[model samples]
Target: MSGMEGPVLVVPGLNGSGPNHWQSWMEALIGARRVDQDDWTRPDIDLWSARVADAIVAQARPVWLVAHSFGCLASVVAVSRLADRIAGALLVAPASPDKFGITARIPDTPLPFPTVLAASRNDPWMKFMSAARWADRWGARLIDLGEAGHVNTESGHGAWPEGLELFRQLQASAPAMTGPLQD
Candidate 1:
């Protein structure tokens, strides 16, 4: 995972992160592009996954994902079909679409690549326990970052240095070495 160049797609939550948001800040810092979602504020789950798959296909090299909120679920839905194209993924403060104890729209299959699930203890949009369960199901490394509600601009993490460090850690993790990165 050390030397992979990428078109890392920063997938934001409902409404997506604006230019001042952390995802935008991170995208610039990493020399990558945003997903440029047509409409993330109210996406159909299957359509969202399709766009993610399309983004993965559009990349010239290995693509990494940095997903926030419900975008995390979209990325998860894509994991099965896009694993060959993805280098890894970093899921931050996943907001469950299934708030009523319904299963997520995404499949529970293990992603065939490196992944980190960063969960907050006090995110108003999500329950940490449910996030943990998803992490286990996806076989992602669960990082319990103490209460930083939603881990967004409102959470005092606008230019979060700690989150940057975690992203580095995710990059240092093992990548799927054998597969050819998708176009």
Candidate 2:
């Protein structure tokens, strides 16, 4: 979507995004960097967030996060300490913190930078209302995708153009980076 002002960090959920997954396609489409976790099968917020934070630190510019499912959770936590290094975030189909017994670990306060959260009405990972609650808590704009299960390749969302549009919108709304990069 034109020239991006910052690097796009694509963060995938459990087991990682496969070749057929939309995250993989978006990375190919935009040259986005993927945040690879050491153990994708395990959902550990601390470890996952550390990996995401490290990725952001490695970027030469502020980053825009495109995260899915459990990766959404990790990205949010990672940005908590590095908010100034972030341009914006597009979080999709976030897994429920309650499901992982990490609700207390996730911040209940508003996020520092612009963030958009897209959720499905019938996602098996999280209830719609629960997603709404978290969206409000994070002060993120929420987009409702009715009955779109998980919004993954298995749910028939490979090469999701609509999600790309949402990311573009978030990018447009993000504040422009200024001055020198923080150390």
Candidate 3:
């Protein structure tokens, strides 16, 4: 499993995952730990990235990141520093950094570990094409989830069984390359 033997880390977006959210449901089903950001509603990209790094280092076992919306941006930034410890990542419905008015530069460096980016065609946070472009830039396998709004609780994704399957896919597959796949 390489460094992929640890518990999954569930990272939520914006205001944090409510109890009824899919992320919360994932936490229970997969025994995943939520990266409890110090500030949830108002996020500082660097701070969130640091928190993710801290979470990865704190774990004795390997870690797989499950990040949704804005949390996806944070994970990508943190992975630049902690790629050695990551097994894989599942990024779902990433929000536009510009929309949130986050000034911190989103890293364009391709991630070292295996990653799957799931994009919803009808997501309000970002255009599907933009998300697909990001997936390509990050060297992640893109999964086009047609018309699934935001893929959040409000999007009627309380259980998100399909997402769970995608997460499992990441676990089963070995990283496609060693070190960063591309610049």
Candidate 4:
């Protein structure tokens, strides 16, 4: 939180991060808010991204997105048109766009804000190489987690300190924002 000048929004994927999930822990640890979606079972990028975008817009200042799995995909899409209000982003264990049949919807160009994408070699939702490719496409810095399964609570990653450090790094790397947010 040292370098962050605004709220941190946590976006969870699929069923949404449970109470024991790292996203929940991070939210409590750093006073971050979660972007609650209307439907967790459905992987509708349009609906999910719209919720994320609205959450960011509602923030009084710039925001940093901490997104996981399918939430990562939605977050990127949500920020595409609102990058100026973003401080940065830390995307972990992003689900494959192909798996959800939304590959065409995800942007192929670099993200407008500083971003870090963490990927695991053994995540069932997406191949390691596929994550690497997406990272490259988004011009995000990729971190290899080496066998960490989805980097979720089921993978035994509750209260993950390393992930917190990564978020800090993203904050440090983000360019500082000043003044009021523009409409």
- By lDDT, the best candidate is 4
Each prediction's Cα lDDT score?
Answer: 0.80, 0.92, 0.86, 0.93
Candidate 1, residues 29-66, lDDT tens digits: the string is 87766765787667667777778888888876678899
**In terms of TM-score, which candidate is strongest?**
4
Q: Compute the lDDT for candidate 3.
A: 0.86
Q: How many backbone clashes does candidate 1 have?
A: 1
Q: Over the full model, what C-alpha lDDT does candidate 4 score relative to the true structure?
A: 0.93
**Steric collisions counted per model:** 1, 0, 0, 0
Which residue pairs in candidate 3 have backbone atoms (N, alpha carbon, C) closer than 3 angstroms, thus clashing? none
For residues 1-183, what per-residue lDDT tens digits would candidate 3 score against the true structure? 433456689988899999989999999998999999987988778889889889988877558899999999988888888787788999999998888676357877688878899999999999999998889889999999999999988989998889999888787786432242232
lDDT, residue 112, candidate 3: 80
Clashing pairs in 2: none
- From the highest TM-score down, the ranking of the candidates is 4, 2, 3, 1
Clashes in predicted model 2: 0
Off by over 4 Å in 1: 1-3, 100-104, 176-183
**lDDT tens digits, residue span 49-101, model 4:** 99999999998788999999999999999999998888899999999999989
Q: Give the TM-score of candidate 1.
A: 0.90
Q: What is the lDDT of residue 178 in candidate 2?
A: 44
Candidate 2 lDDT by residue in tens digits, 49-130: 9999999999888899999999999998999999988888999999998899998889878888888999999999999999
